[model samples]
Target: MTISQAESHKHLIRTKVWSQLRKVALPDSRFHHDYSSFIADFEGSSAATDLLVSLPAYKNADLLFIAPDNCIQALRYRALKDGKTVLVTTYGIRRGFWILDPNEIHESKWEMASMLDGMERIGRHIALAEITKLPMDIGLMVTGTGAINYKGLRFGKGHGFFDLEWAILYTIGKVNKKTKTIAVVHECQVLDEELRGEVWDTGCDFVVTNKKIIEVEDASKPNCGILWDKLEEGMLEDIEPLRELRSMKK
Candidate 1:
């Protein structure tokens, strides 16, 4: 983690740009109200349905979880109750601070303990390794974001966990072309414009909001190959959870 490496970190720059853009209210957010209405309109939309129940195709998935928001709620509650295993990532607020929830489905609030326990109740409990590494032990991974380009992801503002999670999974030999990852957001989150992306961000295979199950084209996936040679040493350290995980792995 030399100073030179820090100066050249593209992810940091992308994060800064995203933070700036997020305040502008991109065109995608315009659909937030409409998308939310659609979710309420459809009888079988993912979010409005039982959070725990599995659909036909997504049934076999090892993991199926959604981010908690005004748009899509975590379905793990219904999943665990239906006797299925689920995984969830808790929100981070401060230094080395993470709220781990196991059975987050049961608890109404979004925090670490409830989310972790709920996931554990159905099966293994996992979270995005941070904005640095991906989960290797789990078969499925899930997340949500503010907006998604046609390829299925946009820079996550200042939160680096999404990309970091994918990179770490690649390091541990977990994610690949075949890996199934999904993002759930309100329909307003889908973007048609190309979001300037760095070589480190991990794109999603599927984007699900309240209205539809969007299967993005493969060519749109950013950072398809691991840039192991491009591993910015200090950049990883800049993201605290990654540093901790690396230490534990050591």
Candidate 2:
């Protein structure tokens, strides 16, 4: 099926799963255990091993990860505290709620604060780097899967910003074989189908959800021209510093 067709199908599934989750209200204890299982499983898994073997030393590795909220996997703070350099996006208020960075949320800052705390738990030094300023040698891009509907392919609310975020990194030559891109989500989010590829979507090498870590093997890389095109579209307009940097690049 075409990418658009796949996206549409996944969108429907995501809506269904979300409705189910709301009716059931995932319990806190279950959430905690699933996250813990992922941390433990990945710690000894091939994905983790491959990441360390392939990438440069984390002692100097620049890491970019997301701050999670809205029922995403609650990654423990221990991992964050052990990293080298960390980067985070800012949260904004929308539709009577506060959404985490680059997205809209309708809730209070308390949830956002909790997400920030998880990001801080990694305890790595903060480096306010945009996609443009991202050091050429970033070792990993770890993200928490926010409401991945559509069988884990399409991202939250269809803005496609997360894929753009990765594409920006790829376009700038910051991500390569050695750079690890991992997503943390709950088990239920993993779809039973291939995540449809698109011209702009950033394909992840590792998926760490509630059940286990899924490593997408022999994954297709984003097209260079398409990636640059994404970078050219004044996509960073909302990001002030990024906008300034892009202007300088121009």
Candidate 3:
């Protein structure tokens, strides 16, 4: 299929999954109207987090790279409580990346620090160059998904922020082959059909739901760094981190 056709198919899948999620997803007062536009906070999010923490990858990892999705809030809280450092991007990656170290936060504020609003307030802003200078050993990488299949193909909220984030990290050597990637979603979000993934699509090694854990065999992920030609227009101008990264590359 052509690139246009492939994208259209992915959009259809996202729309269908979003509609299904709305029925069972927990209500978010912050985004009451446009549930489809954002990743739905589905029921059993806490349960999913519980399962994720039980994994060996999570237990052994000192640093985690988590996406800024509402469903993964519980996981973030648990990570901090367990004394794990988290690397997260601002919402839509609009403001760039932040480093949330458990050592820096007060124990009483961990729960608050896990939330998006709290993360922005409490987390320290780290530039791209600074991040590269830090330790690059990320053991577990978790992201919230709009839809995923047994093959580990994942679809986000149309925007490619997560994929870009991965590319940036991979390019900077923060993420390596040993890093275990997982996608947390509701059972309803797991698709039976094989998704046609693009070259730049980032897949997961595992899919965690409230019900069970699925270990994907040979998950597909981007093998290269940033695909400069595939980036959206004005992304560099809008996201400071990207601009900083671009300058570093030059």
Candidate 4:
């Protein structure tokens, strides 16, 4: 199938950004830029993390749906320290999710709860069945957009896992238009060119860069829940957690 103009442009931008960052010899040596991930070399991560934590959504949320990203590790730790319940996906939502309760974690192990390996050690794993039952609060979604225009259209590594995550939550009535979704990115990722976005794509309600927080006004977001017809076969098998949710829904 031929790619759309927007997708084509997104690819170009990805290549350009990845190459340029590599030339500069980033602080982190593990550099890899794939179709759906721009991780491991972001420069403005520290400032972005601060900006994200400062948001009211982060401060006030009782239950937070946070993405598993190294850039947002501090946010996770801070949330836990603040006595918030945090829900994070397990590597592509394959193993489902991990729920971290501040009271459950030892004060000394709060750092461990935020790290990937430490998450399994300190947090409780929750399958789709249990996760679907919770009333979600704000979400801190991690995005790897090589380029995003002012319109708030985001381009992922191309796999659309972020969208799928949101769809799953939406299908269970866990989120809605009022849900506060935030993304922390570098100023460079904010581009000038517009990209065509699909309705299923979960656009950010608030964008936090190293410099400031940009509230995306009248942002175009998903109109409905997950469109199961658009899914390929064996999806449930691939994402093990979905298998349970599908069965429960039936």
Candidate number with greatest TM-score: 3
| Highest lDDT against the true fold, candidate | 3
Residue 190 miss distance in model 1 (angstroms): 1.5
TM-scores, all candidates, are: 0.55, 0.58, 0.96, 0.86
Q: In candidate 1, what are the lDDT values of residues 111-141, reduced to their tens digit?
A: 3322433323333334335423433234455
Cα misplacement distance, residue 10 of candidate 2 (Å): 2.8
Better of 1 and 3 by TM-score: 3
Q: Which tens-of-lDDT digit does each residue in 141-230 have in candidate 2? A: 655443342333434445454555555455556666456566555555555655556766555666655345566665454544224343
Writing each residue's lDDT as its tens digit, candidate 3 over 43-65 gives 89888998989999999999899
Residue 50 lDDT (model 3): 88
In candidate 3 the C-alpha lDDT for residue 67 amounts to 91
lDDT digits (tens) for residues 143-190 of candidate 4? 444445677776556666777887877776666777777776667666
Off by over 4 Å in 3: none
C-alpha RMSD by candidate, in order: 8.9, 9.3, 1.3, 2.8
Instruction: Kindly report which residue pairs in candidate 4 clash with one another.
Output: 35-157, 36-157
Measured on C-alpha atoms, candidate 2 has an lDDT of 0.43
How many residue pairs of model 2 clash at the backbone? 16
Runs of candidate 1 exceeding 4 Å displacement: 1-57, 63-73, 93-137, 219-241, 248-250
